[model samples]
Target: MQAVFATTQISERAAAFLPVERTDGFEERRYLDQRQSEYLRMLAELDELLLRNAVQWYQQQGRNADQWLSAVAAARQESRVQSGQGSATRRKSSDVFSRARKLMGERGFPEDQYPPKLVGFTPQQFGLERVARKGLERLKWELERYEPFALSVYSGATREFRTVNAPVRLPVDPLSPGEVEETCILTGGDPFAAGERVRPGVLSAVAGGAVVQLPETVSGRRLALARWIAGADNPLTARSIVNRVWGWHFGRSIAANPNNFGSTGGRPLHPELLDWLAAEFVDSGWSVKSLHRLIMSSRAYRRSSRPADAADVARLDPELRCLSCFPARRLTAEELRDAMLSVSGELNLQVGGIPNRPELHAEVALQPRQVMGSFAAAWVPNPLPAQRHRRSLYALRLRGLPDPGLEVFNLPTPDFSCERRDSSTVTPQVFVQFNSQNSWSRSLAMASRVLRETATEDGAIQQCFRLAFGRSASATELRQCLQHWRDLEAVQREAVFRTPVPPPEVVRDAVEENTGERFQFTEKLYGMDHFVPDLRAEDCDARTRALADVCLVLLNSNEFIYVH
Candidate 1:
């Protein structure tokens, strides 16, 4: 079978564009004694050729004769060091010193004695860089031509050379929008047809083989690829994605680097099990749901997130080589917000549709956004409950606009398909939770729900624990929470209960354009005239107030925010 190479492999040739300085500053005796000396000789010759070319360029431009003589002296000294076979300190300052003296001794008076210099003699600036660039251009041309010929035969004949006919492919520079558009249009290739050959397979003349061009897009490509990759026949892709999923769940993939599966990537700890799961996932109709079920069903996933085995602490298992215990992980950006809304009885579970705008913070919502040429209209949430309440996944994702809260929680940008989400803890997350008005509103709604369900202060506290931790609170926790509720109740009696405020009826603003002009328009809210959820704190008695306290705590705890 003929071997194929990735684009990266071909691109690796560009590394040669960087010139290798032949001045190793060592005597040639070291390399000469060893069979490896021939390599060094060739390298020195290449470097000498580079320097000679530079000198010739300068001489061509009518430079002083001293410049050419100086270059020749320098070359002689370089040759001496490269060829001499003596101790570094003892041997020859003579050959180098003689050259230096000769360079210094030269004093010229006649214009005719001047050495030729390249048209512009600016003091050795950009000379080396220019040479390197020229060398690269020559190399590129040589490689293009060499592909057709330059073959040596075992029958002892001179290498044959043939003219090159390879197509010249210009790279797209991102700085030019026109170039980018052109590339996109050219690469897009017959999008009108469902099954059209977009790119032709490349056939190598020498190799007598071809590289196939696969379809770039397909209706069920992801599903089909998933099936093939996860199947027992394919070991690479299953291990790759599984490790990725593991990384998302535990903040560390079993293979360390999830995407890389070559010899360089860390070997799997439970290789057999990984293969088993990969095969199982494929056998189970490539069902994503089934895969999740198997993973979550494992004893590894269910073990207490807390460290229970103290003596086993010595066996830290730094690499987490075994299925010891469940790893605690921070909730994903979507999960964090979704779980909060779910707990607070405010999550909208409506499925797919054209993305509806959700309520954004006033500071963010009112901010000006730039579209193609002019400022785009400000974001306005759907006024109706069913519309605004849809899942975050299904929300109309703006490429230019990201929810500030979600951003703080490490939500991935929508520009590219994200393989996994990053969970990073930072101070911004703290401010997002405490300072954002959205969090406050959510807390209040949760508080009210708890107060309505559990009348007494103690009962409200227990309910808070139940809602947040999914279990009843201990006696001590209940006592502490009861005290907190009693204090809150006194405060609530003096201060009236608040109702959920209605969304804005209309937002009027001048839209700014990229050209710096503004246009005025009033964006109407569809259902703003309807009754809004009332935040009527006064309507509820002390009992309902207590449940609100429970709800508030439940919404605030780490238990509510993390997934183990």
Candidate 2:
């Protein structure tokens, strides 16, 4: 790729004379061959290559390849325009005129003499009609087979390569004026409608009481808007950012509503503190880490949750406005689930790629989900435990169906930005924490880890405490856990062990929108087919079951859920 770019340049004289001359100028002919070889070598290194453009390039290198390549390029440009890549105003007629002029120029005809109808001219003039048609046919066949290929390009001085799997082809016709107007009507507004045409300009209300001029192009307008927001003279951006960060750490912003700073929002509790933090955040070059360090290292930040004189402080400042103590907060849904997996030694720490399919409740996974004219495939957990046990942050989030456990814990609907999560106590959260298969599985896993790592009951209890609360259990708590375990073990000593039942096949039913007919389809249970089931009461002995029971209780306790 680098070699291709380095060897190409455009000829100014050709650009002046030809309507559509080759933009890429090859300075070194030998370099073009070398780079092509290098590109092929790179493609060979990949597991598979899908060469879309490369096939055309290969055919072009034979007879009058330059003209063939130009036709191919024009086709690709037309395809891009059809796919909505080209700007609205220029995409309609200008691209057609440009291509026609280029074709006429290549044929040694005067640009002015080229008829507008020739914009839809076939590639036969360039002796590429047969090859282009053949290549496109092959592309379609290969795409159906999921075959992949690499695309290659070369012009005056530059060369480029790309890997694509789908078919590519030329546009049939340039968009007519009526078609362009129709598109504008659908997406923006009718250009002919009264008071409907949009003109680019900054809002007078927001532009410091004056209308600010802006360029017409999308990129130019975006750049101007970005500058206005991030400009040093603008006082709101830095302050808003600091407030949001502060809210995340403290569970409440200095200005109570982090999303709204207008007249309707709550007044800042500590206006001076807010301003100072904002100023410091700006001074530190908008470094998030620097701001975090400054805030967290403060003496006020380190204050204990239980102040030295709680009663006195409460009476003097009921709101705790003096920063007397740190606020206690419940862990967010993601944090709670991730923490459980971490403690159970089952967490897959692999980072960043596509969203992972974590195990969801059977009911939710098998539920029928509607899509265009059909029921979508049932939710499938990743086949391997490593993939399925990834952090909750990596879990696939669906708008219609969220993971039930996370939802129970108040994971917000993702349709809007969530400034803060609601932490209201609810019964569903209790059911999910104690009875759900996800919770029981993690508890059993934690139990196995404790027994494997410890020798005695006391040691196992201590290990459980350390994993759950980051501290050893107190004497009273240890004694209570020991007694509970002993009692449970005695009760389960004579219990029979049974293998767990596999999930039932999911049957989804949907009505056809056009035919008014109902149909049912069985969704594949991909995850369960390969799942290595976790240890259950049936799999473990009486003693282990008792320990798992104890672990389950600890997991559901306040100590595991709250952060002070």
Give the Cα lDDT of each candidate.
0.53, 0.63
Task: Give the lowest summed-lDDT range of ten residues in model 1.
Answer: 1-10
Give per-residue CA lDDT, model 2, range 462-499, as digits (tens): 99999999999999999999999999999879888675
Q: Indicate the worst ten consecutive residues by lDDT in candidate 2.
A: 176-185
| lDDT of each residue in 1-564, candidate 1, tens digit only | 011111111111221211442222122223112212222333344444444554565467656546556646785767577557754222222233234334444644343343322222232222322232233333333233222222221111122226422332322431222211111222355644334222312223322343333323212223343344344555466666666666665667677656556567777777787777777766887676777778777787787766577458437753444646666677887777777677667787754334556777766776766543334445656655455656778666778889998889888888876655677889988888765656755666677777667767666667667767789998887777777777877876777644445454334344232223333433333334442442445656665555565565566568777776
State in Å the error of residue 447, model 1.
3.1
lDDT for predicted candidate 2 compared with the true structure? 0.63
What TM-score would every model get versus the actual structure? 0.55, 0.65
Top-scoring candidate (lDDT): 2
